[model samples]
Target: RIGELFEETNGYVYINLQLASYINDILTFLFAFCCFFGTIKLIRLCRFNQRLNLFIQTLQYAGKELISFAMMFSIVFISFICLFYLLFVSKLDACSTLLKTSQMLFEMSLMKFDAHELSGAAPFLGPFCLSLFIILVVFVCISMFITIISDSFRRARKNINNDQEIFSYMLNKFQRWTGLKKANEEERYALIRLEYFDPIEGFPERVDQLLDAINRLYMTQISERSRMEKDEF
Candidate 1:
């Protein structure tokens, strides 16, 4: 698209671009996508990593909520786009076209819009609509979107498996097997006591600790009255 636009256009006397002229641009675009896919592949390869795995879990868990939000947002966003394009199409250059109006409104939602440019077009309707957009779209809709994602993220983080524990377990195992495990990490290891550190000893795995922790958290809190009665008795 960019190459087509940058092509020679002298009063519609279009001139074909030489391969050498736009080849660099074509290569750059291809390389950009290559890097992008490569990065995604790297992330996929390390999907077992703690934070990355959590983020993946969050998106998976929040799929329904995100889809609903996207639907609602599209309706509201498109409505405002038409509203702005209709009201300011003759006045404001930014809202001159449907696409431009949408772009401007997206910028507005991000708080990147210029109020002066909008207000200068239609003094009354411009500021009025701008303020309305700021209040409803920027504040209300965007905030709701954020709230939904955050709530979903909270649920995801809470329910997601603790991959960090698994990663640590694997790392420690590798280190131990290679005789490269650090003393500090050995000290931090709860599986085996420092005094009882031996290859022959019965070692409790990190998975057992993780299971116990999950059981503790999964159980409901004890009643205060029951505890008080037990203490009194």
Candidate 2:
């Protein structure tokens, strides 16, 4: 029945490969547009919060470290491919070309290739050499990659904490200058919440209040000084 319907409708019931390709292209464009729009909004939101901004900066630095690690890994991987080809090129019929050799080595590193295939290719010592390659690639190299990523994450976290400490120190200085008491736990929580809001809209009122308090304190001190001087005369 399905074949009869297709024959009757001249295959119009199903989408052709070209139509599917067009649909895929349109969907990809829409996805890209959404990602670009979302990124802009996220950046605007980050600007309102010191902690978020610092986190983004730390992430950027960590990305640079990851990119460097990737470059080094590529070099090492290619070197291993060349070394494997040189060692077994004559014995292995599959590794007739550099590309084929790289593919074979990559598969072996993932433990997907058959051990017997290596033995068949290079009978006497193939198994031992392949084991060494697996240990070097899968164990040592992969572990180093994970360690590099872990170190980058730790560094990013440390930098973020340092930035927060500096911000807290500055906030304390401002409180002292305004003759205000140290912020209580609740006030600190509120300040943290305020960091996510529009700085220009919400921050100025608090600053203005502090400045008014400072002015009042200064005027009272001046009046007290003048009164004492008059009494002495």
Candidate 3:
């Protein structure tokens, strides 16, 4: 009956599809494993040689750029494939009459029936899907690698900024603590009088000298404060 023939045809088609998918999965896994391990090994070997390491680092940067471009490219490529497959290829091979006749002439015509149009779809789809799958997998891996590098660089920049801010803050605090405000005019004159009139042996007139330095520091502090406010504004 025609029903039996239709069932058999469907079975053959399912078998072919299943076989193609299996092969695609196997190929994709192998390609990913090899590419990943090979890249890591190449980087490790490059590290042992300074010149080679520089070369590899340069290559890695270029590779990342290319990979980003490829990801964008793959999106377009997949879109084209889907459009072609759904709108064009799927309409060609939905039916076949290759086994309907007994005569040699009928058989030849039947052979050409599936061969001329629908036959190429299976072969092309297998390779196309395999290639697309591989590209997507590699693209995702590259993107993740780039993301990690970007995050690390961002964190490093933040840390350096924080360290510089801390250093400046500590320096300012130390300067303020060690360098006192200058004394007034009267205070300066008093200290000068003390240095000349009250002399202590071996004490070095410490208080009077200290007062003079404090007077000078007060003037310097006012100048510095004006400069700081100007800079802030």
Candidate 4:
């Protein structure tokens, strides 16, 4: 059918052009989404990155809250959708169908909705409902959503497992393999002797200063006693 469209035809063609076009569109849509999801899956391979790992951990911590938030959002959104659809179905083209109504509401939530048409339709109720939706969904619900993610991120950062060393090891190995970084003697020896080394230093600068002070005091006392004995003799 697509081939015939390219060729010069003089006769009456009984081709269902819409069918082929629709089929092509559906395939294109599926291909686009498949590519998107495949790219998202590849993120798991790069989890050695600290920022990416932290983001994943944050999501994991917020999973339950997000699910519940989704449910609450859907309920409120659907209620508004149905209400808008029923009230403005005959008056506004944007609310003529469920899909259009939902899309229009989403646009409203994003503050991209053109309210002139709606206001022209219902005069008072249109502006009132729009204000109500912005307050309830955009301000309140979205704010709660942000708060949930923020709290979860804070918790995740605080409670993150001490796998940072492992991630750093992976990154270093990868860099060395890619020739982006080289393994120096110090790093190599430190890596090898990591298990045998103590993480804390036994003698700090403060302890060294204290020892020097004690030695100076002892020397001063001894010299003073010798001077007094020599004077007495």
Q: Where does model 3 exceed 4 Å of error?
A: 1-39, 48-55, 91-233
Q: Best by TM-score, which number?
A: 1
Taken over the whole model, the C-alpha lDDT of each candidate is 0.80, 0.76, 0.55, 0.90
RMSD of each: 19.2, 14.3, 24.6, 15.8
Q: List the residue pairs that clash in candidate 4.
A: none
Error of 4 at 54 (Å): 1.0
Query: What's the CA error at residue 146 for candidate 2, in Å?
Result: 0.4
> Model 2, range 179-213, lDDT digits (tens) per residue?
79577897779889977777688688999999999
Clashes of 2: 0
Question: For this target, which candidate reaches the highest lDDT against the unseen true structure?
Answer: 4
| Regions of model 4 farther than 4 Å from truth | 1-39, 162-164, 170-233
For model 1, give the 10-residue run with minimal summed lDDT.
Answer: 2-11
Q: List, residue by residue over 146-228, the lDDT tens digit for candidate 4.
A: 99999999998897775677978787899999999999999878878875755356457669889999999999999999999
The alpha-carbon lDDT assigned to residue 207 of candidate 4 equals 90
Q: After superposition, how far is residue 107 of candidate 1 from its true place, in Å?
A: 1.6
Looking at model 3, residue 156 earns an lDDT score of 40
Q: Name the better of 1 and 4 by TM-score.
A: 1
Query: How does each model score on TM-score?
Result: 0.62, 0.42, 0.23, 0.61
Order of candidates by lDDT, top first? 4, 1, 2, 3
TM-score of 4: 0.61
